[model samples]
Target: MLKNKSWWSQTIQCHMQNQKSLYIFVSVLFMMGVIFGAIIVNTLDLNQKNGLINYLGYFFRQLKENSIAEPSIAFQHAVGDYLKTVGLIWILGLSVIGIPVILILIFIKGLVIGFTVGFLVNQLSWDGLWFACVSVAPQNLLAVPALIIVSVAGISFSLLLVRNRLIQHRGTIYPQFISFSFLATGMGLLLIIAAGIEAYASPWMMKEMIPQVSWITVPNGS
Candidate 1:
């Protein structure tokens, strides 16, 4: 156990030493995407805003009616989605050209999150803030870090490939590829946990809170 701990510590230290800049860059890029997404909420015209609001209202009604998918089904779907995203990132890490695409994927992930939270807070005020905390924040608390780590890892591996092709032509890439695959697998596991929280915990919390919110109308029969 101690040896494993030490190995992990050394690995992390090495990663930080070599890839700290990439981590900062990826994190900043994601935050920029998030800010841009929030700004987009402000740019929507009245009609557009109203349309989104109506959709949200409908969703909330469904939520209040407990018409949402069963937790098991939701968990399956969420796990599938998370797996696909992680698998894509892992694949992207194998190709040099995929670096930019990996970055874009991370940005889009952040943008979607920011937009969801921003729209909720803008429309619902305190209630929206509460709802976002309960629903959005839970899964993302695990997911965002997992994504950022995997994104950085993907970019780093792609860069390594470039270096191997251009600077050092004699080395085998199998070892590095194995390490990258392991990292991706670990992050994927973390995302699965996040999916579980999203599927089970968030819905339960949202359901409990829905009745207290003044804005979401309980549908006629519900």
Candidate 2:
């Protein structure tokens, strides 16, 4: 007679298998995406940078001018960004709308990236483009995958609530928590990378690679 493993061992085995697959797949994809982003950013032009800088400068000037009257622009911007990020994280981790929220967040992320990349290419030519890229790209590569994994966990939880098909326990939450932990690990990795890039790579690029950008104003007295 063949011996059968217990339920707990089977579950642990499945989890281990899933984890190994994810580790291999996620790592390769993240690295490739980061490499491609760097290459693309390396080729942006200067006229575009100046044009974007001029427009955004005008926008910021308007923002500052309005701030003098309201003084809430800064607060509003900060609060909005924080609430969206934090609130969605919570919702996805526990709420029924987690997957859709993830989709929405992903869409927003893509758009922000598109706009930011366009702005950089237009403003900095090649150097500013690359500088902004290395500064941002390193962290984003890790964080994006984490967000998606969290979304999947939320989705799994919601599914169990609706139907106890694959999930054997409705009350237990270890699986969801485990997935969220993976997401957190990705985010933590991103933090380490972001901090290093901000402190070291940014300064080095600013000092050595940044173009000596300047504007001339000559006084006439003849």
Candidate 3:
């Protein structure tokens, strides 16, 4: 067991060492997307802000009334969404031209997250902060890292293909492809755990927190 564990650890260390720059670039890009998303919230017109606020208020009322989907259904939907993203990234890694698209997807993921959290905090103040802590942070703790790792792996593989094509290098890509596939599989497992937290634990926490946040007023007749 120790031998296998050591081998796995060494393999991961080697990959990280080799792909250090790619990791940094992908991470920075995702953070830039997140910051841009937050800025977008600040740029919203009064009418747009009011529209979103009204929609959010209605959703909160549904949440407070216990009208949300069942945990099983939520779990299924979350798993499907997570897996689709993973699958797309894995497929993209196989194509040299897909690198840009992969990067865009990672950025979009970060943007969505930033927007959701930004909106919550912008409108709810401290309550939004607390609510976001419970609702957004939990699953994202796993999901974000999984996504970033997969994004790096995908970009690295695509770059390898690009380099080989440009230089006419005759090295076999089979071994690296295997490693990349394994990494995606591992990330998929991690995302499943994140999905479980999102579908079950997050909602439970949100329900527990809704009443405690004094400013989340439910609409009349809700």
**Best model per lDDT:** 3
In candidate 2 the C-alpha lDDT for residue 144 amounts to 54
**Which should have the higher lDDT, number 1 or number 3?**
3
TM-score of each: 0.91, 0.50, 0.92
Model 3 per-residue lDDT tens digits across residues 40-102:
999999999888887777777778788989989999999999999999999999999889999
lDDT of each: 0.87, 0.49, 0.88
Give per-residue CA lDDT, model 2, range 95-185, as digits (tens): 5546566555555554455556545554556754675566446545544554444444445555555554344544666665665555444
Clashing pairs in 2: 45-125, 48-122, 48-123, 49-122, 49-123, 49-124
Off by over 4 Å in 2: 1-52, 55-87, 123-125, 165-171, 178-196, 199-207, 212-222
Clashing pairs in 3: none
Ranking by lDDT: 3, 1, 2
As for candidate 1, its clashing pairs are: none
Residue 58 displacement (Å), model 2: 9.6
lDDT of 2 at 61: 41
- lDDT per residue (tens digit) for residues 14-109 in model 1: 766788999999999999999989989999999998878777777777787788899999999999999999999999999989999999998998
* Residue 84 C-alpha lDDT in model 1: 96
Ranking by TM-score: 3, 1, 2
